[model samples]
Target: MSGNARPSLTMKSRCLLTHRAMYGAEQLGSLPCVLHTIDMLIRDDVIWLFWFDHQGVIQSFGVKFVQHTPMFLLVLMALQRFNTANWGLPNGLPHGAPADEFVKLEELTAEHSTSDSQSSSISVNWSARTCRSLHFVGRCTQIFDALVRRRDAAVAKLSFPDVSRVSEAVIVQRAREVQTAKFDLQRHLPVLHFVADVRPQMSAIREFLNITTDACVARLTIWEKLTPIVHLRGADFRRCWFELIHAHHLLWNHGIRHLDPSAANMMVRYVGGASRCPQ
Candidate 1:
């Protein structure tokens, strides 16, 4: 809700207002959602939401306020096609998204099932991309691949079983690295994403309809569940510093820049009873 809104808005009013746009992202596969009050961006009043399937599992969503349409869906898949080497904490889309082999490309999952039939892959055919932005198509094949798209591919690689076959020490190190990647993916990355517009409606239009907005594009990102960073203590806290450094280099060299990182945005990821911190 905007601060200058003529009439103060209720939460339900806000939720109802945004629901159609959020639900339009049919590929996210989330169940019905309820808007929550965890304010994310003050400038756009972007907040959080909770989604629950029939079985009652919780899925979290955070809204990223932006003006232009995000091109992550294109840029990330292109990166996977261009890059040959895999980063330690794989850019999350992990093994990679092939531009041509669009079929069975695997939607992201922390479970990292080696079997292909388990998940649905995101696909875009020539005809489907007709309405997309020209810049989006150009960047998808050129430099500056969508940083957020890079996130999904990064997440796909997390939790992957390290297949390194060397000395016992090397094997042990690689396994730890895999654990760290999975922990970081859940703690720091956006696993699922979609864009929506949340602009204002004219008074007359509002009275008759619920489906109009301008170009105030916002990207809603869903992430793995996380624990508060406050849970880290003593040795756990100190160890987190090193892990954060490792995660940073992996992301920076591979092409994702985390602009605003702080304790407020960081989380404590526990894997096998150890606090795995990804800054």
Candidate 2:
């Protein structure tokens, strides 16, 4: 396929094509079976089994595949949403945000972009930049918090392995530790309190805190990686398709079978006229 050519297939057609490219033509009939297996893995919490097996008993290609599949699906969903938006389709972004809120977000992004080109001088308008940065960070935290809550609820329903053979005291302690590690609104209260109490003398400390918080937030929002696809040219998209093909071959070389391979599970990063799989 030529790099500059638009993908001729509709989404459904592209899905099938990508699957065929990943798993080979003979394995197409097994796609449904693969998907069912992945569903069971997610529902049963088998992804965690590998971690608990200290002797590497469950550390196999299949176990690694199961553990990674959830993240793969997340990336795929993000890509599909980006592509939908790129095609001028309804993006299905969260609908409850007021129009004014979106306008504010756009305004912030515009101002941020404008600031990037200005000279790095002490005269720079740091106060406006700081406020914009804080607003963006807060919005990101809210989104991340929502995602974490939903995940925690789903995880609560999942069936973990029976540890009844272990002491009840140990299990209870472990459970408490896990709960404490989980992110909740209460965990961020101190940081929020500090930001709200900003003092002139604490400018350096506040900047440090902002940088730390931004780094943490960025780590939690891998879905943002998909946004680049919205700006990709037709040639870059085609290159991405080829990169997915290469990824399939690479997996095969390592004797790893991506049974549920599909367009949604494959992600391509485009940079400097080249394309590569994020995985």
Per-residue lDDT for 1-279 in model 1, tens only? 234323333676466545533442221221111111111112253333332111121222333333212532343455466432211111222232234322322333422222322344322211111112111001111111122223232111111011221222232233334434354443543223221111121122223434242211111222333565767777877677666656666665545444555665566666688776644
Residue-by-residue lDDT tens digits, candidate 2, 22-45: 333122112111000111122232
* TM-score to true structure, per model: 0.28, 0.21
Deviating ranges (above 4 Å) for candidate 1: 1-214
- Give the Cα-based TM-score of candidate 2 against the true structure: 0.21
**Which residue pairs show backbone clashes in model 2?**
none
Pick out the ten consecutive residues of candidate 1 with the lowest summed lDDT: 135-144
* Candidate number achieving the greatest lDDT relative to the actual structure: 1
Q: How far is candidate 2 from the true structure (C-alpha RMSD, Å)?
A: 26.0
lDDT of 1: 0.32
